[model samples]
Target: MNLKSFPDEHLQSLTSLEYMWISYCPSMDNSFPCGLWPPNLSNLSIGSLKKPISEWGQQNFPTTLVTLILYGENSGAIPFAKADDTRNTATTSSFLLPPSLTYLYISDFMDMESLSMGLQHLTCLEELVIISCPNLKDLPVTLLPSLSRFWVNYCPKLRKKCSRKGKYWPIISQIPDLDILKAGRT
Candidate 1:
């Protein structure tokens, strides 16, 4: 279905919703409605969003969220503070994620260059998947102690960096399962 606008009242009423998938809705222009998300929401998937990742922050994210999936060719960067932004910058970013998150999937972001360091906050994250983002280049250096599975597909530069002998190997080598798919392969 085509949704042009999502009203706050409509979203606030789904207090018991656990999973929601909104895709193929090009007419929607707003970041997932802030402060209107149900407290019990655990999984959310949004596709074809034109808004920047910077527009979604802690306030909009449900603390109960466990999985997040974003797919859109027009999506923007995953906002995070720079490592050098502070003296003790190992964990400092205005961009906050819910601690309950376990899986994160992002795809088709044509303009993305790097993942935000803010992801380090997801201490409970177990799986991460990035697909079809051609411009992505780097990943955060912070260790994801709980991450057991990592997957990347159709990201040329990122694939090169994550190679066995590449610069990103040290960062991802600890993961129990790692899959890197080249272009044209599933």
Candidate 2:
């Protein structure tokens, strides 16, 4: 039985990889390699893994990662703790995220808050979509200047607020160039 996670023996020569779908690897503890990646990797969709993302893992992510889609049952704060095993100490929040990321979609993250705030670092990000996150009450005001498209669906409680102009809107006016769709609107 082949228990190795990476199908290919070496990724050294590979310069670019597109649209990778990785799922259901029981022994795969970490997501990406510790260092080095496809220089042009853009679209990445990963799901169904046990190990959470560590602080060390974040510092070596692909700089070219553009669109990221994460689907899983692990819904909590961003999982990068100091000292790898210790969960108490507060470490510097500088994780190596994709610099060129444009779109991000996170589903079933019921209690996520920091991501909305941390995403301000992705200066090139344009669109963000979140669904089924019942615990998300407020979005950080920092994600406005460059974000153009925003969509939040199936979050019933998020729809009760009114815009600054007194119109019933789910998301607030903070989304500078948003194409917002209310629940009842077609």
Task: Identify the leading candidate in terms of TM-score.
Answer: 1
TM-score of each: 0.80, 0.64
lDDT of 2 by residue, 1-186 (tens): 223366432443577565676655546555553435556668876644555433224333477789887655453544422222223223433344565889887666555544544455677878877666555555545554556777776544443333344333433466665544455311
Residue range 82-117, candidate 1, lDDT tens digits: 323343332222344577889999888777788846
How much RMSD separates candidate 2 from the native structure?
Answer: 6.2
TM-score of 1: 0.80
RMSD of each: 5.0, 6.2
Which candidate achieves the best lDDT against the true structure? 1
Give stretches of model 2 more than 4 Å off.
1-4, 7-13, 24-30, 33-36, 53-56, 80-95, 156-186
lDDT values of the candidates? Answer: 0.71, 0.54
Error of 1 at 170 (Å): 2.7
